[model samples]
Target: MQLGCWQDCIGAIDGTHVSAWVTGPDTATYFGRKYCHTQNIMAACDFDMCFIFISCGWEGSMHDSRIFNEILINDNVTFPHPEEGKYYLVDASYPNRVGYLALFKGNRYHQQQFRRSQQNRTAKTSRELFNKVHSSLRSVVKRTFGAWKNRWGFIRDMPRYDFANVQVLLVSASMALHNYIRRNTGNPTTVHLICDEEEAMTIVNAIPEVEHDNDDLMVGDEDPQMALMRLRIRDKLVYLRNNGMLENI
Candidate 1:
């Protein structure tokens, strides 16, 4: 898959807080560790990075994974599971599951992105590799969230009514609209979401260049450090090569 995931990826999962203008007794429930009072919204995106799920109105104090488990369970959501099976990408704040890939401390995604950065302020192989791979694929989900928030700005300005109910409706409507856009527009934005095997192969064959830069990172020539960097870069390059995304150019 373009995401380097199995073809059945239902997309990445993440939560964002929509700031509210009103606060009262419920503020404590809605105010999260981030020190902000808002409604938490959990969302799912597909391969094309379109939002397929958006559950909102939960107090910000709730964990993202819990919100997902509560609202997006079977029967409630109408979307069919991917043929290979459905899975989602989530941050460390989420627990791992057969249906979800969690970015925890030991996870390749997080370790490569954060571990080395913590130990070495400058250059780290894993960091470089993570950045490279992250830039390439992770942007899809991020962009999806950005677009959703942009379209549903009302999520932030919830009226002083039953904030919870309004929040739910807003999220549901947003997702429905997102799906509508994909279906009506024929995936003009995705280019190839529901492509046939041949079409998928064609896309796979069109390898894009991997944009990597070694200049900004500081490489320390020492034991464990240099070795770590080498290992990270090696692994990352291997992945890129396997994906046929490294451009000869």
Candidate 2:
């Protein structure tokens, strides 16, 4: 968690799709990428490589920011932040919110810098070294997702359960089991989660409901407030891009 020191460390936030086998005339609803219905799961994991919170069972149709608003931000979860304040890492798809920090998108320079830092190799400067070390620490949670899906086939292919609620219970049980094994065995490398954005997007975009819609509009047009909110986020994203704080444009 120490990027030069713990002061700059924050947990990373990301989501993945968990496939589940569902039934009824709603069978089409369960068919997700590669022919499966995906449940979007989000989690926050600290620098210690431990999970702070995890939420799942969201229909694949929901956007990342909307899920964060409903499950994490509005849900009233709190975390201990460094002196600078609490922050979480998220992707470009998320909204520009107050409590979390997002990686910048659209800048090749920043992206290259980040990629080099992520490798955790020796760097010329202390700041670069810290960035690499800190990024590696946050990578544990991403690995967890990989282990969950690969080791537990139920996650890769939804298990046949009597009800969707039961399917959820099974998923939770699998996660709990994963935690138990990791804690008792003291093995951090037991699982590996795929971090490739293209792979993730393939599954996420497979959902028919999401494929058909581009915006969250209730009617033909967005409300003024909603439009403004979108504009504000866009501006903030641009600001982050202009600053070296974010790497994407």
Candidate 3:
């Protein structure tokens, strides 16, 4: 939960692809950075591995930033707007807007990259250091997706539901159940009620349906105020690291 200098961090936002079954001839619309046909699901997950917000039913080809921009601009979507000083950790693929903090640009990011960089030296530039710690804290969203897919095979492999049927709602429904399960983790009765995957799917299917739409591109322009905010955070992080005060983070 400690996000280095991002003390007001509420959670992380990212996109995940779940296998999708397409019937139309233009299946290319459903293929993105992934080779397989999938639906891009944009989610915001807190440190507890529970989804707080999500945007689903996007075609596989849509970029994460596009989805983010679409939701933010769409009047009907009603995003869970962060508080005045709070923000969410988003990867480089999304825009670093007012309430979305991202890793420093044009520097080392990702765990594996940092691991390789570490093998060569013990020292790191401020940008590299920030990216390292930023990626670490942002991993909660990925882990949340992993836990969701691990628990529900249906999410990993869809049963070829129609486009207008459960397919539109599957990702959100799964996440809704994920949050519910995470909230009641210690309750034996909840465990017993959802232990079976089929029963869990049945429960998900019973929830009221939600729908979605598509949008256009979002120009990746860094906001000046957010840029200054990141600079301030970097300065604070440097101070903490220099003083050996970042040990708790």
Q: How does each model score on lDDT?
A: 0.56, 0.52, 0.73
Which structure is stronger by TM-score: 2 or 3?
A: 3
RMSD of 2: 13.7
Q: Encode model 2's per-residue lDDT on 1-249: one tens digit a residue.
A: 022122233567877778766667866654545445777777776544455677767766566667776765353655333334445655555543444544322322122455565453333332233233334544666766776677687676665775457887787677777667667776654223344445544543332331113353223223334333333333333333344433321
lDDT of 1 at 50: 75
Best by TM-score: 3
Ranking of candidates on TM-score, top first:
3, 1, 2
Q: Pairing residues by index, what is the TM-score of model 1? A: 0.60
Clashes of each: 0, 14, 0
Q: Any residue pairs clashing in model 3, and if so which?
A: none
Question: TM-score, each model?
Answer: 0.60, 0.57, 0.81
> Candidate 3's residue-wise lDDT over 87-155, tens digit each?
999999987888998878778778776556446333267777777778877887888889889988887
Query: Model 3 Cα displacement at 44 (Å)?
Result: 0.8
TM-score for candidate 2, please give it: 0.57
Error of 3 at 152 (Å): 0.7
Q: Per lDDT, what order, best first?
A: 3, 1, 2
